[model samples]
Target: MNNRDEPANAVPRRAVLAGLAVLAGAAACSGGPVGPRRLRIASSAGDLGAGLADLVNRHLRDVEASVVTPMASAGTVDLIARGEAEIGLSQTDLLGVDASVTALARVYDDLLHLVVPADHPITTVDDLRGRRVSVGETGSGTAVTAGRLLAAAGLTAGAYVRSERSLDNATAALTRGDLDAFFFSGGLPVARIRELSARTRIRIVDLSGWAGALRSTYSDVYVVRNVPTSTYQAPPSATIADATLLLASASLPDALAYDVTRLLLERRDVLAVAHPALEALDVRSAAATMPAPLHPGAARYYRSVKP
Candidate 1:
C-alpha cells in the first residue's frame, strides 16, 4: 500500500523498474567499457610520431591515443607544454629545460642535411652568402639548428635571402629551381630526399667542420655524423646530428607514464618493423635525456628493468 504522505507526482514502482531496465539494455548493447582515457601525441606528419601513436592505440586497452601532426619538432614541444598533447616527438636541441615537459625516451638521432642542386657552385656554409635558402619552416627544430650552424659559420641573417618551407615544399621548390638550398634534419635516409635525389641530381653540403663551433655553444647536443654516399648517391659527407626525444606532459599519472614507457621498450622489436629508426632505442641511452629529466613514472620503469 502507498503511504498517504507520498507525493501525487511520484512515479509508480513498476514504471521506475521499467525505466531502469531500458537504461541497462542500452548500456549492454554499447559493447565496450565507458569513458576510456584519451591521449593526443603531437609530431610531424608521416614521421615517427604517427607510428608511435599507432603502437599505443594497438596495445593500450584503457587508453585511446591519437596523433596530432604539427610538422615541426618545436611545434610538438609547444603542444605538449600547452597541455594540448599528452605526448610528443621532438629533437633534443628544441627541448630546453622546461618543468612542464618530461622525457620518456631518447628515440633516435636526426642527421642534418644541407641539400643543393648538383650543378650549384655553393660548397661551404660561407658560400651560402647572397643565395636563396630555406632555413626550414618557422618554429621548426630544423630552423633552429640551421640558424645556429649558419651563425657559427659567420653568416648572419642578412648574409642570405631565407625562405621558410617544410621538407616537402623545400624539395619541390629546389627541384623547380626556385630555391638554391634548404636545411632538413631527419632520420637516416629521409624518403622525400631520396625521391628528390632520384629525379634531380643533388648534393649534401659538408657541415662536419662546423660541428665543433656548434658544440662549443650548445654543448654536446650537437655531434658529427656521416650520411653514406650511397644513400643519396651524393658525395660522402658528415653533417651535424642531434637526438630525437619522446616527451610527455609532466602532469601525466605515474601509472600511465610507467605503462607507456614499458610498452615502448618491451615492444621495441615490433615497432622497429614499421620504423627502422626505433631499432636504435636502448634503455641506457634512452634514460640519458639531458636538459629534460625523465618523468618519474618513466624512471620507475627503467629501474624495474635494470639488469
Candidate 2:
C-alpha cells in the first residue's frame, strides 16, 4: 500500500489543513488571541517523519493550537529552500548544500545496514574490499556515509569499491549476480530489509571494529551499531552494521522551532510511543548533533534544558 492506502485518521494534507483552518478562524474571531500557530511539516514516508508529526500533534494539541501536515515529496531540504513548507523532518546531510536551512533537532539515529546475500562469503568489513556495492542514490546521505565508511576501511571509492543508487534496484541486481552488497539507513524494524531478507538469504556486514575509524574520518558523534539478531529472520544471524539519521532544514519559524525543540525534549515519551527509534532522545543527547547546525530556537530551548 502506498500513501493512498493509509488507514483513515492518518494525517493527510487536506485533513490537517482543514483542521488548521478551523483553528485559524477561531483565533481570528477571538480578536487576535496570538492566532493559531500553524506550521507546515514535511518528510518522506517512513518512521521518522510520520512519527514526528504524530508526536508534534499530540504535544502541541493544546499549548499553541496547532496541526501537523505530513508530505511525501518536496523533501525537507527542498521544502525549506522553496519555502513551500515551514518545517522539514529529513536529514541534515541532504540539506548540507543549502545555507538557508538548519537542523531543528536530531529526532533519531539511523543504522546503515550493509546487506549482502546470506550465502555470500563476505562475513566482515574486510570482506567488502574490491567488491561491487550499491552505496545508494547519488546526492543521498546513504551514499555519502557509505563513502566515509569505505574510506575508514582504507578502501577508496570508485577504485576498490563500486556504488549504485537504491536498495530495490540493487537487490534486483544482486539477485541477478550483478552486485555484491547494498546500504540504507532508517529506523529499527525496517520493513524493506525484512522483505528483502525473507526473499533472499541476506546478512548485515559488521563495522563495530571500525567505530574509531568511522568517527575519526567523519564526526565523533556517530558510533557503530549492532544490528540485533532478533530484528531479522536470518536463522543464524549474519553481521552487524552502523548508521545514523538526522533532522534538517531551516524552515520553521524561530518561535515555532523553539517550541518544537522544547516539545521533543519534554514530551519525548509521547514521541517514543509512535516510534521506538526516538526513544533515545534525552536532555543529554538532544543537543548532540552534527553536519547541520541547530536552529536558533532549538538552541534556546536546549540552553534552557541544559541542566
Candidate 3:
C-alpha cells in the first residue's frame, strides 16, 4: 500500500555506465586480477541501500565486486563489527570509536528533514508543541537522531505527541492528514520526498541553528549541511547532517582495502548516477574520517592520491 501513487524519476543508468568506463584505466593500473572478486557491503534497506547496491554492481563489474547484502545502516555496521561483512555504509553519528571497525572513507551526508503540511504553522523544530509527529520507527537510526535533535531544539520527550512509524507509513499518513509532521534522515532527493512534493504541498522545517551545539556536544558525527534550493524546487534550507562512512572490519587485508578505497574514489561520478547525493564525496577529504582508525591500505591509497 505504501507504493501507491508514488512518483519520481528512476536513477539514470546511461550516465552511470558512462562514468564507470572512466575507471577502467585506474583499475588496470592497480594490477587488477584477471577475474572480478566478490565484494560485499552493507547498507540500510531503503533508497540508500538499493541505490548503492546498484552503483556497486554496475561500476565494479570490471573489478568483479557487488553488494550482496541489504540491511539497515546500523545493522550494516554491526555486521562489520561481528566479522560477517567486510564493508558497510553507516551514519557517522551511529559509529563508536571502539567498534572493531576501520574507516575506509566518508562517502556522503545524510540531512535531517522535518516535513509538515505546507500550510502548517510550524516553522522550526521548537514549534511542534502538542503536535502529532512521527520521529521515525522506534529504535531506528532516524528515531535516535530525532531524539538528539528535539533535545537540542529545547523540545523534550513529552513536549509533543510522538509516534513510531516507517518512513513510508509516515509519508502515507502525512498525505492523508492523519499526522501533523514526520522526520526523515537520508541523502537528498529522497524518492518519497520528491513524490510527496509533486503530489502535495509540504514544508521542510529548518534545523540549522542547532548544528553548532550538536557538533560541539557530539563531535564525532554532526555537521551543518544545506539542502539545495533545487533539490525540492524551493528555497535552500539549512539542517544538521551526519557523514555517511564506508567501514571495514579491522582484519580486512590492506591490499583489498586499498583497492576498495581506490575504486570508490575513482568512480564517484558513477555513484552520482545512482544517487546524486554521492557527488559530495571529495578526493581532498577522502581521508577525513575519524574515531575509527583508517585501514592501512586505505591510508596508503589516500596518500598516493593526495596532492
Best by TM-score: 1
Q: Where does model 2 exceed 4 Å of error?
A: 1-42, 45-47, 50-85, 89-102, 154-163, 172-178, 233-251, 262-275, 290-296, 299-307
In candidate 1, what residue range of length 10 has the lowest lDDT sum? Answer: 45-54
Encode model 1's per-residue lDDT on 23-89: one tens digit a residue: 8899899964688788898887757666667778888888888888775668887888889999888
- Candidate 1 wrongly placed segments (more than 4 Å): 1-34
- Per-residue lDDT of 144-248 in model 2, one digit per residue for the tens? 667677777767775545766566787788878888888876666566777777787777777566667766665555565656766776643322233233344
Q: What TM value does model 3 have?
A: 0.79
Clashes, model 2: 8
Clashing pairs in 3: none
TM-score winner between 1 and 3, please give it: 1
Q: Each model's TM-score, in the order given?
A: 0.84, 0.63, 0.79
Error of 2 at 189 (Å): 3.4
How well does candidate 1 match the true structure in TM-score terms? 0.84
Candidate 3, residue 126: the lDDT equals: 78
**lDDT of candidate 3 vs native?**
0.77
lDDT ranking from best candidate downward: 1, 3, 2
Candidate lDDT values, in order: 0.87, 0.65, 0.77
Model 2 residue 209 CA deviation in Å = 2.9
